[model samples]
Target chain A: MKRILFAFIVVLVSVSFAKNASAQSEEELVQICGMIAKDATFLKDFRIKLDAGDPPPVQRVPVILKKDVKYRFSVCNSKDFEGKVVLQLFDNNRMLATTYVIATGKDYPTIDWVCTKTGAYHLFFSFRDGKAGLAVGLLSMVEMM
Target chain B: MSRRLLYILLVLVVTASVSSCKSCSNSDDLSQDLVVPDSIAFNDPVPVLGETVIEEMMQNIASPVETAALIKGLKVPFNKDFLLTTKASEKFNTSFEKSLALGIYGCDLGYLNMYEKSSFVIDYIQVIKRLADDIQVGQFFDFSTLKRLATNNENLDSLVTISQQSFSRIDNYLRESNRPMLSAVIVAGLWVEGSYLTTRVAQVSNHKRIRETLGEQKTILIFLLKVLKVYEKDPSMAKFLTDIEKVKALYDDVKITYEVGEPEMVEEDGVIVFKQTDKQIVEMSDETYQKIIDSIQKLRADLTKF
Candidate 1:
């Protein structure tokens, strides 16, 4: 009787521990260049990518978008680089957006936009004239719940 | 032997049943305690993202040209006469010099930023010169005229009323219209930048000896506050207003604290010592620094809000 009771207690405790661990592991941090909406609106995200000038290192940020939603795009730099990072979003070889982000070293910042058309879009981050920095990131979109 | 085995089995069954029942009851009680507030529903989508409404509201209220004109016209007097003649003035002047230098630096960057991004062609240097002239002459001030215009003269009882109206219009437009997000973001950036300038000016005034002689800071604050008040009525403007309020509250606290002291002199080592409390100045500077950071963050967020 004592053996059966001890085994049941062990099984319950292990089950609860597994449940908690799985719950925690599922919550992951995702950085994305933009989010897509149900209406096919695209938002572009910007980040400063450090490149050593070879094949171009690219960081992919996860983006979630619904099938039909309106979206826009914006860009920002870390506070230390205020007045340093200049981001431009382009669509099909045309300039869609540009901004000179001034960061004051105390806030988490990102640019925002609504996606209007649904397809692959390219976003480019470059240093302004007389400024130098490397940028590498892929602009991806996902479905939002 | 058979009777003993049955008794043990029965005991085990009872214990298991009672434990499971207790667990079920506890779960039920927890569910009962989970009351949702009226303001928020489980089905209602959380505001993880939305259009940059604040930026849109600011743009709807006025164009950049109109805003620049308003800013230029709102100039207030910056004079030595208003300072604690010996100590406070000297310190104030020193700080003012540093601030002016910083302003110039920011202006330089601003001009560059504008030049790079703005499709509208305007001579920024010329505008800066005009701004300087307005500052020195102390006529055709931006804030004063803005207050006047906003109030519609005697028809409006107070600047606050005009602000409220303007805020409502912009706010409504943000909610009701499908405007370009970039436009809204740009407007918001300009507003935040303008507010930062105003707040910094106020910090300078807090150290001044004369309360009546309106410093650059107070003029900007009143002007910006009025503009902000106009936006408060709209939901989108309301968010921006919250940010402005945070900055304003900090400014007010510093202003009140600084005003409490009387300008007094102390003699030390054969030289008459005149001072405004260093503690106050430092505190005010710190607050200004923090507010600047907050403003920058808001500005960055605003830029993205399209």
Candidate 2:
């Protein structure tokens, strides 16, 4: 009887700890969004679709460069939806270069771009439907790598 | 009594375990609620146009008289005489120079704004590349000289280049961060300023002259409205559009005052002083001036996000 009681107490403690950890992970994702929104360099737009079943469509922003430039990007996903985001970069006319960002803990997956052409480009982010959410951070483009 | 106590203890432990299991199951729900969604639906992709083709088109579109008026409304003292003569007046000079710089900057910035918007519209409407080409040409301005001037000094050039490059970097950051809407807002903001300039120039000029020079105010307004309509669909642009509306109202008020009455004829002292309500006109001009200043400050604040 004492052994069963001891096991009960242990399980309860672990469960509480798990809940706290989950909450922390969720909070971190929100914090990432806040940080990105506050950044002065990158323009930002976000949308949330409440319904389920359909994979959320990737939002594409076209960039025109007068000169060739290199770029870097990072994306972080919530713990509940880690390993769900796929980042894609396109050069001018829909040429897809796929990059994967594996969300571990709260860290964003990062990608680098060495743009060789002076033309239009599109950046795409694909996330898992329903279970996962994403936050993009640390986007930079410069003439030099 | 012992049996009863043992049963109660077992019941308590079982109940506690069940509750804990239930809580663990609910954690997923809690986490899901807090999770940021994976993707946001964006407007369709905009068709891309070649830079050379776009440049050629803009050259064909002659400078409208409204363009000059809009430049004047910005109150940039671009004339070398105005800048040199006014140096002694620090307050006036500083204000004039800043407005001028911003006006120039705004024009350069308008290129990107028009590009993104026209591209988006083209993509969504599946319009032909020629239409996109036309719109792009209509909006393009040659900034080669300005870029050279801004970057003339080695030290200043590096700084200016850095600042301009930062825009692209920041744009990349937003894209990576799953906040394309914010970027879109920034782009839309540039368009709003451009549209405002177009509208201001069109309305402030004499109707007959404007019609002769730049077609009509209605045509310009329609073009601007189309741009605004595309931006209005995005959630992030709501505040920006509101700001644009405020400026538009001020412009309308200025127009109403200017067109309210018939031209009055007044004779003064010895000269045939046509009863021109010049004073009233000046006051109205001052009001419009204040509105422009307020709008610039508001725009700067909105742009701080980028």
Candidate 3:
């Protein structure tokens, strides 16, 4: 009887902590969404949350990009999240642009791409080092060429 | 008493396992509520467009602000005559009508912001707020802040950013709430108004870029039609489907071929930038372009009518 009672108490405490953690992550994302450049028009935002494990899980978002348009992609990580974000733009199976450079082990907060082809494009978001994190990716139109 | 405690333990364990996974599925299962047919009852589940496809189509719809900015760049004069009157907002009785009008006003707001027409923006914003409220998505719009930004010329950029963000929030909320049908309608409204503005501008200006941009709508139209078809089970959607399909038929002749080129990557300002090398070639004769323009104009007219 005592063992069952202890297990129930443990479960209750875990649920409480989990709920608070999720809420804080959301609040962190909302607070940092205003970091777009002055000349750019905010188009959309993609919010991602992944569990920590080997080979961080990726979230894919499909978007249409027009030819001759300059677009900016920026990402913000939650303050409590240990993992940094890696945002990549892809054309079908071909990876086009990414925020993380594997050679130098560096990550950028933003990427600027000038699209020459008008079609469906995908955005893949994940974290470095297989770490659990919460992040938001912002897509903005920088210019039209 | 011991057996009761064990039962409680099992229930608690199951509850904790289910509730503790904070990062689970991101999308709600909207197919059952949204895609079910009203005319006939079926024991087996009916397969329809997945929520992810709907989301992609939603995100892919071109923003009105981008088109308006292009018009501004082209030095085209801001013509208030092209805008739908705010009075039309009151005429929309159904959720479909109100949502579509909400999208139209959203585009018009974008145009007003792009042209820096501060005087006419407040009226549109007010109507948008009313329409959004009717659809239960008005909470996304921060009216006081938007009005404050609209009234000040120095805050035009901020006004544009906030307004666009508000629409994005509404889109997210609708998808999350299993109301993607309304969300799809809203985007259709935005696209129609945007295409109308472009075609109208194309009539007078000999701008090659504008014509190319207008021609590219062929692809977007196909995507929009596909998304709308998934929601055709709704009684209110038949008229919308018909009108949009007519527009799609008109876009059939628009030829958009591409030229493949070598992709380039360069480091600019310490950032790795990849410039897409393939070029899009939009080929449309004057006659085909004119037919598309007429079709779009009529469609927009029908949609805006009470």
Specify the poorest-scoring 10-residue window by lDDT in model 2 chain B.
B56-65
DockQ of predictions, in order shown: 0.01, 0.03, 0.40
Q: Output the better candidate (1/3) by lDDT.
A: 3
lDDT of residue B81 for candidate 1: 24
lDDT of 2 by residue, A1-145 (tens): 6676666567656755654554334325534644432322222222221222356555454443211223444455554544366556554344334444233332234444443322344556556553345544334332221
lDDT of 2: 0.36
lDDT of 1 by residue, B51-98 (tens): 333322221221222222222234433322211111211221221122
> Which runs in model 3 stand beyond 4 Å of their true positions?
A1-23, A27-33, A36-39, A53-55, B1-58, B269-271
Error of 1 at A15 (Å): 98
Each model's TM-score? 0.21, 0.31, 0.83
Q: What is the DockQ of candidate 3?
A: 0.40
| Candidate fnat values, all | 0.00, 0.03, 0.57
Model 2 off-target regions past 4 Å? A1-8, A23-69, A76-84, A91-93, A100-109, A114-121, A127-138, A143-145, B1-227, B230-306
* Better TM-score candidate (1, 2): 2
Candidate with best DockQ: 3
